[model samples]
Each structure stands twice: as structure tokens, then as C-alpha cells.
Target: MADYPILAVVGHPNKGKSSVVSALTQNDQVHISPLSGTTRVAQHFSLKLDGETVFELVDTPGFQRAAKCLAWLRVEELPADQRPARVAEFVEQFRSSGQFFDEVELLKPIVAGAGIIYVVDGSLPYSPEYETEMEILRWTGRPRLALINPIGGDAYVAQWQQALNQYFSLVKQFDPLHASFDQHLQLLRSFGELDSRPGRIFDQAIEQLEQYRRQKLEQAARILVENLYRLLTYQQSSSRLEQAAREQLPELLPAEISRFNQHLNWLERDGQQQLEALFLYHRLESDLARLEVRQSELMDESQWTLWGLEKKQLVLVSAAAGATLGLLADAGLGGSSLFAGAIGGGVLGGVSGWLGLDWFKQQLPAWLQFSAEQHLLGPVKDPNFAFVILGRALSHARAMLARSHADRERLTIHQAGDHFMQSLEMKVQIRLLKQCKQLVRQGPQGQAAEQLRAWIYQQLTA
Candidate 1:
């Protein structure tokens, strides 16, 4: 039972309570409104790891009848110990009463044994009026903490912190919209410090949350591996036709390339959805348009600056891949053979085809044999283009990692000081690039697939 702690997030209307829950749970589905009293009832969101619940967060409607509720509780007709019963009596009388409905909804969970996590807008000046609400919560005699969430700026944080301390046993400041990964954990750890609740399970909650974080990173790595494989190896073909129809091939071919490129773009969008869902930000649409990593086109120059490798790095890896193919070609021809001239041309062609290949150049596959009936394109070419695919994937993953789950602002990724691929070791980069090339050639087997997954995992998370 200690493994599950129920926390009720309560506050005044429009004070960013939903934002706090969203950030803590990494869930974007919670509705947040600027208008007063958006959440009219209590909503429960649970944090689960491996299909089991770790902790639950209850987002309750904000206080509406604090003054009246406090006024009723202070009648003094009831003894000190009986005040809790008075509070309960008030709920029984007004649970469905129109004016006190919001207050009742917010207080129901606290009366039921959930710990209180009171939220306040630190951006607003601290006032005496909210004391009525705090006094009402205190009358319930539940374990409680105060959260000073700065919705706009921190000009009043010091004041909010000072005033909140007198009422709540613990007072902490959190900016739900901008809090970092560490701040989320620290806030949860602070909840474990409440004195009223014995056998606190926050330590267990923290452990599960951390494990969930690493598992999410692993999911992102798998996405890069499998999606990159399909995209790099995607192939399409059209049989060449003779006669008057042959002239129309020009129009049909470019359209085919466009269609294939569109498919790759579809893969990217699908991947974005997967990563967002993994972290529980399922409702928010990606704000990729104005960011540095935005891809206006598959190989847009702007994206290249953000996710592409340096030209020199691409050249070195490409040269190594070419050399490897050359050795294979030479080995295929036996050692003691002067009759090798017959196949010598084939060897030079193979080596030069790899060395001089632009990978990015818009050309139909040279492998397309002009047999009486065929023309084919794709199985995306090597290193440079593979880097292009990888660069975009990495940029998207990093953006999702850095964003606060509660942030609704248009998704934007500022350029990392350097390219994402630039951080990997040279050999890792080469091996990864070669793997992309191999996928294009024969597809990944069990061993190769695991190697691909490991390399992608390192680049994404290491």
C-alpha cells in the first residue's frame, strides 16, 4: 500500500494547477484553461510503470466558496475536535449546491485521505483573501504542502514563499511550464517529506519515475533503428514500356521519386507520434514549423545545418565504405589469375561507383538494367543521404526530450551548439553509416539488426 501515494492538486481558479499535474505526470491530455474554473470535477491521472500503478495525481477544480466555507466553519457552535465533522457536514449540505459545488469537488479528495498539494499563482501579488481557502483546507486536518507556481514571472515568488510557509508544512516554488527534468523529480521528493503521512512511498515513486525515464529513452532508440531501416531500404520499381508511351516516362519518373520521398516523410511523422506517446504527451501536436530542425523538404539546406554531418566527415566515411567494397571485389577474383582482365573492369567499376557516388544526387538507380522491360529507382543510397535521414530523426528526438510536457507553445528546436551526429565517436559514426548502407543492400538479419539497434541507441542517448 506504501507503493501508491494519492496527491490532490488543489488551488484557486486560473492558477496553473493543471499545468503542475501535466508536468509531473508528463501527460499533455489534461485540459488547462485561462478562464476561471475550467476543471469542474476531480480527475485522476495515474503514473504507471510496466502496467502497474506507482502513484496517482488528482486534479481538482479550484476553490470558489472559500470565504463562505471558512465563514461557516468558524461559527464556533462546534467544539475544536468537531470542526472536522463540521467541514464534512458542510460538504454534505453543499456538495450539490450551485455556489459551493467547486469547493466541494476540490475538498472531497482531501477528506478521503489524499495528501494536499496546494497550488498558488506566484505571479500575482500575495493577498490576504486566499487565507480563507487555506484556512478551509487546514480545517480538514490533512497532510499538506504549498506549491508557489509562477505563471508569468518571479517578481512575487519571495512573497508567495514566505506567506505559504505559515500555512503549509512544506513550501516549494515550481514553474510547471519551464521546469527541467531534475526539477520534476525534486518536486516529487519534496512530497515525500510531509510529516503527517507515515510510511511515505515517495522514494518508491521516485525510483519508478526514474526507471520510466530510461525506458522512454530506449524506446526512442528503437524507433530510430527500425524506422531508419525501412526508410533507407524502401524500394519502388516500374517496368519500362516501349512505343509512344515511352516519352511520358519523364513525367512519371519524377512523380515516383516524389511519392517515395513522401513515404519517408510519413515515417518521420509516425515516429514523432510514437515518442510523444511514450512520454504521455499524446494530445499535443508538434510545433516543428518555425524551429531550426524544421524540414521544409527532405534535404532542405536549413535542416542540413542543424542535423547533417560535416562534409569532411561524410567524405571520410564514404571513402572507407568504398575501400571495403573494393577489397571484397578484389577478393572475389582469385590471386593467381592473369585471365582476370575479363573481370578487371567490373572491379574498377564497383570501386569507382562507390567512391564517386554522391548519394544525394537526384539520379535513378544505376542498378536498373535497361532490359527490354524495366526501369527502377531507390533503396535509398548510402552515407550522405543516410546521414540526412538520421540527422532529422535525432533533431526531432532531442526536441521532445527537452520540452516540458505542459508547454503548449509551438514546438521549436533551437540548434544544438553542434550537429547531433557530431557528438558520436568517429568509428561509431562510420559503423552506423555502413550499417545504413548494408540495409540498402540486403536488409538486417538478427545479428545485424541488434547491432543496428545498439549503434542507434548509442547515438540517440549516449
Candidate 2:
């Protein structure tokens, strides 16, 4: 790993040095706080790909007595070529002393071979007080980059940039809380430009990081598709059935429906957890609308538009699906010679599609079935149910993808206007509809589910 880049993140207290490390490594476990002296010692973290460390970052304590340390270093008349050795002597002298503990810890990595990343709050006005720390770091003679973190706003960014340009070879504005993946890659690219020693290695690291992200997205798609299948085809059966249970089953529908909904929620959450873990977000929390089937009217029109398809598009798709099912059933019964069954099925399907949630309201009891020997809750009958499940999964997955590891707040998944299903071409929509029907009948193990997973991966990449 000596051939790979090692960057020492040095800064004043509470200026988002740890936040930069968190975002760069994509590790949520990194400690962060607004209070001073949060990181008290130097710790090394590595970004590894396939069990190989790509690069390393040293999260070191902020400069506690920079002015005093610099004053100590200047007591001896040293030439410019020997100044780094003087800084090294200061670290050796104060390694065990309690006076410049923070300064020694931060300078240890820079005295070694680590490149410097000096962080400062771009949101705050620049002052001469911070120059003490900057001047101390400049004495180390390490390749340096200055990250002006706009912790609040970019109002003071240019002010910081003007000052940092004098000490650092590169000055850039980086916001850890909201940086996209591309920004992260670009930042790493800039790290490569800091020094020529590991330029090719840093480029390889960026490529590996992109590949790892794509693989995680593929895994996320699989998790989401599997969850959609499970939710759509889920059934809750009762073993407490008696001979006369059919008569009482209708009364027990509410409790059974509640249990079914609970299980659905659990399944959805389980998939979400898998996705979060895949992206290395162990402590992620989300504020999302509930994913469940309502007993009153399936789903509201507004929700359908948000999570499934628009009213007009859903109606047309559902009507076509119904007519196909009707024609298939007619052919299976005897032959397609019976135009009556096909025509009736098309009209009923079209009307049901037009009715939307109202049709689901009327057919709720049908979904809750009871026979002489069996009592079951569901394999959701409505075609629109498929879109609802799929839409919610994609929403949660996309939210996780967009989130930065440096964020401490709960992820809020808003209901967006354009749904993935709604934007698809009609043929693609029809193919998805067909695959969803196959899922209900054949479970999530066959070629149909594979096709759905492939489509989901395509959407994720898009």
C-alpha cells in the first residue's frame, strides 16, 4: 500500500474534517460532531476493493497549538531545504509531552509520507488566526490540497480560496453532506493531481470505486425485485379453520388483513435494509410513506400517480391486461370461438381500469377468499398492485443511492412526479405487466423474475 496514496486530513476543530473522511470512504461508522475536540487521536482508514486497499486516509486531530509549535520550530536557523526535518524534530521531541499533543499527532502522518488535506469552514469568514496552522503544515513540505467545506453556505468561499491558494497547491470547494458520486470521483481525481508519485494508482482506485458502485446497484435491483414479488404474491393462511369457519371468515377479515399488512411492511423493510447495507450505510434511517394495501380502497388516486402510474396510463394498461387474461381464459376453457367471453372480459376489464381504486374496493372480498377446506388472504388480484409495489421499492432504492454517508439525518423519500413505470414505452410497460402476472403465478424463481430483475437493473443504471 506504500505505492498507493495516503492523505492526512488536517484541520481546526469542527470544520468537517471527519465528514470529508466519511464521504470519501463511504463509511457511516466514522464519528462526527459539531463540538470541538471530537477526534482526539490519529486514526487510519483504508478504502479497499476486493480485499485490496486502494488508498488510505489518516483522520488526525486538529492543530491545538499551531502557533506555539511553529514558534518552537523557528528557534533554530534552518535553511528552506531543511525545514521539513525541523518539523520532524518537533514531532520527536513532543511525542510524549502533553503540551502539543494534538499538533504532534497531526504532524506525524505528514512527517511520514502522507499528502496533506487541509480542511476549513468556507461558511465562516477567513481570518489570520488560521494561518498559524496553515503555516505549520506548509513547513512539512508535503504535497497539499485545501478543501473549503461550505458547512453552512458558500458566502465566504471565495474569501477562503484566496487565502488557501497561497499555501496549498490545489484549492477546491467540497461539500461532504450532499456530494454526488461523480463529485466524489472527481475529488479523488484531484487527489491524484496532488502528487505524481501515485497518479496511476489513484486513477485505478477511482475506476474500482465506480465498478463497486455499479455492482452494488445491481444487487439493489435484485433485492427490490425480489421484495416486489414477495409483497405482491404474499398470502396469509389460517390453520384455525373449522368446518363452519367459512361463515365466520368474513368477520375475521380485518384482523387477518392487519397481520398481512404487517408482514408486507416487514418484507419491504427487510429489502430496504439489505440495500442500505449494500451501500455501507449501517445506521441509515428513512422517512418514507408506508408500503401496504389499504382495506378501504386499495390506493388513493394521488398515491397511484405518485408511486404507480398516471390515471390515464394505468387505465389503458390495466384494460389491455384484463382483455388478455380474458382471452387466455376463454381459449383455455374451450376455444377463442366464444367472442362473448372475450368481449365481456375486455369491457369489464376496461370498466374496472376506468374505475381504478373503486374497482379494488368492490373486489376486496374476492381477494380475501375462504373455502370448505382452505382460508387465505391474498395474492393481490389488481394489476395496479404490481406497479405500486415496484414504484415504492424503486423510490426507496433511489433515495439510498442519492444519499451521502456524511449525512446524519434520516433519509426522507419524497413522492416524485415521474414514476419509472410511467416513463416506460408501452411495449416495455406491457412486458413488465406480463412479467408481474407471471410472478403471481410462478413465484420469484423462474425466468420471468429474471427478466423483471434485468429490467430493474436497467432502470437503476438509467
Candidate 3:
């Protein structure tokens, strides 16, 4: 226990103490409330890697009787070396006293070898009243760091920082709700500086944490890609049923289409949930104001306009894919060059544009197919369906990653710019679009999807 570094976050009532713990641990499940004194006792959070504790953080109750506790300790002129024991004695004596319950709970961790992480609400004015808590922590003689956390808009932080530096060995400003991953990591590394004994352990733990974050991002991308493969190739057909059921195809067909759409929705929702978990978030809220209008809305009018490539980008993608097909056709026709193949693709594309997308969708096999008595709705074979699914996935991933663990803030995507697809290089755009098209039409292309997965991983890290 002595070797394991424990950080006990001690502070005044409602000063974002639990928020700091949540940010550092990346655990949204930590209870947080606006009211003061929400945490009645010290709750230990052992930061772990594969079930092995790397370090510990204790979210302790705010001090309710710091001045009283400090005065009682001063009643005895004990030697400097004996102050820690005196503080522990005060907790022992007051355990049965309800007046100092909060003080006793907060001090238990420090008495048991946890280093102090004193939190102060820097948004408010600095005052001498806080020194009672600071002095108690100093008297314990354990390594200490003071955090000036802004809980509101008006940040009079300079005075808070100056005051904290007087008592604690290290002082820092951290916004528990909005700090970036880098800031969280840097704070953890700073904890290593508090004491020489815990320095190496903190270093090793931070190293593991960095690797873990990267792996989680990759894992999320893998999930998205796998789901996209399924959605693109998804098919729902109705056959081998009673003649009465088959004769009711007029009414039954629309139901099948509705069910297929529902399936896609479920797939997207599942992917979003999986992404949230990979990012270590159990709670997510939508941001209506910041998200692209199309993205924020439901799929009624197909809100993929800002998430997917525009019509021109699609034309280029189609041309590229069609060129590949035409080149093979040309080779079969005994042509030595791809020039004829390129012309063939151009004519094919022009014909498609003239035919309209909906007509092409209807013409594709396995979609609205009919026999003497048998009929089918779809595992939509339209390549555009793949693009639509991919767009939704990308939109969901971007929104989730941007604000997945954000405290008290809703998720949003700024839609002032071009679609995410437009930001990619032409080759990647074409490759992704073509891959989706191929997967939907031919079904489950391992090699193409693997390449797309690698691309997605790169995009996420970048």
C-alpha cells in the first residue's frame, strides 16, 4: 500500500473534486452532483491496467470543520516530528463526534499515506478561510499539490495560485470538466514529482495509459469498419412463405423496406454505443446547436449531406470504380490500352446520370425483385446505400469522439465547413467510396475492408 501511489483529492464543498477524479480516470460512472458535500466519505478509485492497480485516487468529502480540527491539534505543543500522529489522534477522537465527521473522513487517507491533492474553486475570490484546510494538510507532512480548479466563469485564479503555493509544494490550474487528454496526462506525470518514491510508478502508469488510449481509438475504428461491412451488405428477402402471404406483397413489401431501414438504424446505434464504450464513456448527450443540421437530425431526409461526399465527389468515385471495371472489359475486348476503357466508363457514368439514382436502385438485383408468386424487398444492392451507411458511421464517430466524456456538455459537430469526406485526399475519398460500393454489391470484401480499416485508424490518430 505504501508503494502504491494514492492521490486523495481533498477540498471545500462542491469544488469540482469528483469531476477531477472522473477526468483522470476516464470513468463517467463516478457520481457527481451540484450540491455541496455530495461525497460523505472517502471513496477509493484504484486506477488499473488489466485488473492490476497502477495507482489509486480517493475522492474524499469536503472539509466541514477544518478550523475546529486545526484548533484542536494546536492545543498540544507537540514536536514537529509528531504532528502527523497528532492529526491522526484528532480523527480517532472525533470518529464518534458528528460535528467533525467530514474532517475525519478527509484526513483518513492522508493519515494512511495518500498524498494530498487539494482542490480550490478558483472562480471565486480567494480568502484566508481555506488556509485552515491547507495548514492541516501541511501538518500531515505528506507530499502535497494544490489544484486551482475553475468551477464558474469569473476566474480570479492568480490570487488562488499565489495562496496555494504558500502551503503546497506544487500548484496547478486544471478545469476538471474541460481538460484535454494531454492535460490529464501531464497532470498525472506531475503527480510523479510529488514524491521520489512514487515517481517511477507514475511514469510507468502514464506510459501504459498512453498506449491504452491509442489502442482504444484503434479498437473503436475496427468496430465502425466491421459494422459498416455488415450494413453495406445487409439483405432482407421474403421467400418460402404461404401463397396468401406472398399474394399480399403489395402491403408486405413496404413493411419489409421499413424493417430493413430499422435494421440499419440499429446497426448505427450499436456502433455509436460501442464507440462510446471504447472511449471510456458511459454517458453521451447530443448537441443540437453545434452539430451539422443534417447530422443532428434523424435520417428522414437522409442527413448525410455534410457527412458524406457531395455529388461531384461521388461522380469521381464512380468514375474511378467504373474505370476499373471497364479496363477489365477492355482487356477482354483485346484492347492494349486503357484509353478505350476510360471512354467506356465515361459513357457508362453519363448513362447512369441520365437514368437517375432511384431508377438504378430499382434496376439492381435483389431489390424489389419479382417472380410468379415470390417477391423480395432488399438487402439494398445500391452502392449509394453503402455511402449512406458509411456517412452515418463517420458522423457518429466524429461526434462521439469530440465530446464523449465531456462533463455537462452535449455532443456536437461544427457544420460550417465541408463534409468530412471532402477533407480527405481524392485517392482516399475514391478508395473509401469504391470500397463501400464493392462491399454492398459483391458482399464482405475482407481485403478492401482491411485497407479501409487501416485508413480509418490513421484518420483517428491523426
Q: Quick one: best TM-score, which candidate?
A: 2
- Per-residue lDDT, model 3, residue 323, is 64
TM-score versus the correct structure, for each prediction? 0.83, 0.85, 0.83
| Model 2, global lDDT | 0.74
lDDT of 1 by residue, 302-375 (tens): 34345645555555655555465452233232221212221234432322232222212244223232345555
Give me the overall lDDT of model 1: 0.69
lDDT of 3: 0.67
How does model 2 score by TM-score?
Answer: 0.85
What lDDT score belongs to each candidate, Candidate 1 first? 0.69, 0.74, 0.67
Which residues of candidate 3, in runs, are more than 4 Å off?
Answer: 96-99, 239-252, 285-302, 325-366, 369-376, 404-406, 413-418, 437-445
Ranking according to lDDT, highest score first: 2, 1, 3
Candidate 2 per-residue lDDT over residues 1-462, each given as its tens digit: 386778999999999999999888888878888888989999888777777777788988888888889899999888889999999999899899877999989999889889999999988999999999998888899989999999989999999999999999899999999998999899889988777683487788888889877877777877887888887877778665333345664465555555665676777777788788788888774433233232122323345565646666665776566576652342232222222222244333322232222213234344445455566666655666687678777777777778888888877765665667788788777677788888777877888888888888887767
**Which TM-score value belongs to model 3?**
0.83
